[model samples]
Target chain A: MSQTVTKKLMLFFPKCECEKPIIYHLVKDHNLIVNIYRAKVTPEEEGYLVLDVTGTEQDIQRAMDFVRTFNVTINTTGKGVTWDEHRCTHCGQCLPRCPTKALHFADQATRQVVFDEAECIECLACIRVCPFNACASAF
Target chain B: MKTYEQINDRIESGKAVVLTADEIMDYVDKKGVAAAAQEVDVVTTATFGPMCSSGCFLNFGHSKPKIRMSEAWVEDVLVYAGIAAVDVYLGATQLRHGDPANMYYPGEFRYGGGHVIEDLVAGKTLQLFALSYGTDEYPRREIRTYFTIHDLNQAIMVNPRNCYQNYNVAVNDSDRTIYTYLGILEPGRKNATYCSAGQLSPLLNDPYYETIGVGTRVWLAGAQGHVYAEGTQHAGDCERTGNGVPMEGAGTLALTADMKQMRPEFVRGVSLRGYGVSLALGVGVPIPILNEEVLQRTCVRDRDILAPVVDYSVDYPQKTGRVIRYANYEELRSGEIEIEGKKVAVGSLSSYCKALEIANRLADEIRRGEFLVSRPIAPLPRHAKMKPLVIREK
Candidate 1:
């Protein structure tokens, strides 16, 4: 019997000019191999995108790195972790410190930080440096 | 209404009040004046999963033993007590309703979810309080106890002689140390026969443990047992690897088709939530108070358990501009450490290490009479809330 393999990746974007298309782009670019899923985004709250990327690790990483070029905030799940946005000031203090550049400053009007889930290595360097105490990880 | 000052006076004067669950209900029904009160700490135990050596072998891994907490009160009280290293058990109903990210156990699909508070409260244990300490600055110190479901139930159902002696040893040992053994549930007992006596019989009945005879065994082999065995065996292989290894090796490996079928049972079914408490007492205090101090101290007397023994060349950053290293836990414990080539006063080590230190500090604080057992008599708001909730709510 054939088995279906799937991987769910959750991406949180503080701000995004283009919304639904981003999901479409990821799927189309990845040849629909990945099942792109979106997380619920709240207003005034930072925008987050959860991508359920179903494909090979390399393919997933390729798609993830592709998303990183946009320079937004992102995070992956299932490694036992949770992030607190309340402590975040969106001062862009952690953007430079991110080794993978998984975080980007949002549009000034939006006061959001883009989280590139694909680029996040879960090293938690951003969490370590965030003075506002907004980041947390679990194992 | 009594002021905070009056409440503090009453508490200090030993005239402080403690209300049971029933009394609290009466007070609420009568619309009585909400006064400062405290909760009496109750300890209970809970059983966990199939007996396996998964969690005990390694310092960290997915297959390790776990317990989860589902109820809000238990989570709040456990957190308020500054305790970590607890296993939160989420039942199936809870997972479906709560959509909790951490519901990673199988039985969670049926029963209501809850958490395992080791050394605090055991299985099905509940404590309703009107007042209790809820502050990080001054955390409450209470005599919390925990037990497992198997032990608690066995104590209630099984006669003392019928139960195994190992149960006592296990419970006593867990009570004395940071570690607790979560009992396993085994299905398909062979040759077990139940017999009941008269109503006035002092002993209820005994389950005669035996094996089936040849004729019965032949019939059983053809029965559902074969299918059950095959399914269980397949599940076991999937949960473990093809070779029956618990976790995948740390590397890139492709999952075969057979492995895919078992993914949900392997990945999603085993939800293990750990709870930790920060005792104001020093890090090592609980060891002694728990009566494992002498053993642990003796064990580590000649050797350093927390010594930095990782291969520095391999573990250290290859492209290092400024590297900060500590000699041992002592240096980190002292709070002064060189970070990135500068003398920086460190409040604590990494979060992992900080949890250990905080737990120790809290334990010590309790020992020093600096902290008292206080619960929230009235539902406190965020500002009045003691410690920030660490675990996120879904």
Candidate 2:
């Protein structure tokens, strides 16, 4: 049986390659479900597209190859955490629980908690202790 | 000196000066307490934290050939139906029936009464299952139905205890990790968890309950409520600092509000791993600056409030009440604090920013004459101490 995986990818396009329809090729050609979290790309100017593409392991690889034919830059953002801002209450309960303090208050005045994926050691402590289930781990 | 009536009159005329407990700290520093008392009409204080002794009473309209529920549950979580034929009380900490609580793993505690209450307030529909022994007037033995808060005749949030004047800073002195309601405690005091709004706490602003008592109107979960009674275990005679603030948990308020009107954001359901479920409540109380002495009390700062550090793995379980050290919010919120010449990381269970937001929101209402400040009909009991339970052999 084939396994399915959801991977976040960052695609950078030159102004000339912006008309290539990369999103259309991802869904129609490879039969992938892409959730575009952020899109700065336009038809006239160079920008980036950050999305979570879900499909079988092989299909995602084929989509990457198809995207590379356009000479666009690609970077895998890792199977890290997808923080749902709506679910987070900013209570700061996940701070001391994280061994590396990956989830700390952005500042004292606002007290908005921000997650630094670089500091997260895949310990899964945030997923274990979060009362609101705001943080999700792919692994 | 000003009277509560005078302050209210000024509020209605759009001439009242309102400030949050957080905002008053700077004002007092710049203009002094006497000046603040003369300028400010009310000081709003708030706390958003877990209070286990919280629950709501709901009255379901009588059904056709009603079952008169003797046992009932809302979305698998049990509700106490002993009150009346159609009334039930859903406790915040009540866990769902047959939940795998530590039997398989260290318990996930996904769904519970608290979650149900939040869903109810959010206008989500839920399944209600009930059973009863049929009576002459009520003939049905079972009922399975879908309902929401709109289906109820009345829904009231009645919390026996809501705000803690001060609280413990939980740490682990043992060599192994442990799970508690305060959150996970790492071994050897590697990390700590403290739950309180510190200076913004309602009772902390009024420490002695001078103006806060039965019949005092308050802001509860984004709606208006009242301090109906003295909360359980309200230790009014606890140890205090030179400024009269309690050094430990003291002065609590029994609050009540219409659960239907409460906003879902303020009435959140929280689950602590290895511990059961609980509700995080938002409550705010307005203190009228009737005199300089009252105004001075509300001018507290985070650096001035203190909490005792205790070992959750041993002392707390054994009720030894051993205090490792005392740390204030200033040191705790610094992200790291030193104890015995070693640095220990700290986290807060209470939302400090949310408390400030609630205080400011209530202050806006007062300034706009939307929320009125009221005087207490009577003062809270003085020198009320909590007693320990004992086992008796007959």
Candidate 3:
């Protein structure tokens, strides 16, 4: 039984090295699913790619290791979404925008909204809905 | 009915039991209005919403040659310095240099005067520039310097208007989403945006403006403040409900508070998408329940406080039959409300969390004897009327 999990990964590519097919090697060699959440790839200097890497525990580890062999730095950040509590006013304005109910009001007495990242599908609904832009990708 | 003096005495003697507006209804329901009126000495009401009519007056002590500052800017945002030589009034809604109105394109209002005030209060060094014509006695012409809020001799937020009694509910009847200070209301009544804390709002609870008046002690941005005057647009002469609460916009409060004691959490700079910037203010007012009528009034619920749902797509200042429907905050806060036929999602610009927090904090302060309730020096006018301006041949 293969257990699959989603994770946020940042892949840094070296300058003037656009020809390197780093993602191809991870999928073909390591058999990992790569979903680019955000990317800044260009024909210029250093570039960064925020990705949702999904596969079995062993294969995902090997995929990250395989990318490192190509001189690509990888940093595993967070699961679904990360909320900056300081920036969040807990306005609860984004509560209705959440389809998955991952973002919810924690206390009826206080009406303060709390985020459960595990339930967040990484659909970026909270990011677009938040008035304060407090919810952001963990990567 | 007990007088305001008797209520203050009860508060001082620790015989006053304080409850938030949200908590008052249940207490009254259990103990009955008559018993609760005698038992509950105060009902603390609060609201945390974007109030655009917010700013501060800063007194920059003095410079070398005592230049009269004709023009002053804090963090690239210009402040009105016409009042005094060294004093400046920085409004929260003032835009930065060359910011497009973006009525059609609708870009984010990234930063403005509100953010500058927040940064200053956060102890961040702000780039300040002032220009003045060189006077014979005061030789200095201009100065570009850096100063924090602490560097200023006085930083007082004397908002001409802060707490609005009631506001219109915003809805978009058009096909596209319209950005406004009322928060974003989606197209075709897809969503509704309301900006009051319902029962917890001070003006909503004290609908008739009985307890809330001039010199009323309030919890302002986490600091002790007072209602100083009638607000700029005090529409006292409006259609009222049977309970004496105005059906539309009504009384407003001019608030004054010291900037030194304010908390950053309570005061936030809000960017209202396409509209502009506004200060997300947290204000809490404690009403001393002097009689059964006061207790009953404080027991008003979210469903009882009604506001007209207005379509924002209507042209400038023209009421093109924009009021589609009337809905209370209870229906608005229920995630969705039935408008025409579609189930419209509802959003509130008011931070109910922060409002509750302020109310609770103030209650705690009162319980600890750190805060005291004060009587209003003057009651609000009962017959004030708002007149519209029109062009005429002078």
DockQ per model, Cα: 0.02, 0.50, 0.58
lDDT of 1 at B114: 21
Q: What is the per-residue lDDT of model 2 for residues A32-77, given as tens digits with 9 covering 90 to 100? A: 9998756777789987876789999999999999999998888895
lDDT of each: 0.27, 0.87, 0.80
lDDT (Cα, tens digit) per residue for candidate 1, span B1-394: 2333443444455554433211233343354222211221110001111111111000111112232211223323322212222222212112223333333432211212222221122234443221233344323323233333333311110000111101100111111212111111112110000111011000000001011111110001011110001111111111122221112111110001111111111111122221111111001111110112111111211012112211122222232222122133334333333434444222211122212223333333333434233222322111111122366788
* Residue A69 C-alpha lDDT in model 1: 70
> What residue pairs are clashing in model 2?
none
The i-RMS of every model, in angstroms, reads: 19.0, 1.2, 1.7
TM-score winner, 1 or 2: 2
At residue B106, what lDDT does model 2 achieve? 68
Off by more than 4 A, model 3: A16-25, A78-82, A120-133, A136-139, B98-104, B315-317
Winner on DockQ between 1 and 3 is 3
Give the Cα error of residue B373 in candidate 3, in Å. Answer: 2.7
Q: What is the TM-score of chain B alone in each candidate?
A: 0.19, 0.98, 0.95
How many clashes (backbone atoms < 3 Å, residues ≥3 apart in a chain or on different chains) does model 2 have?
0
Instruction: Indicate the TM-score of model 3.
Output: 0.92
Best to worst by lDDT, what's the order? 2, 3, 1
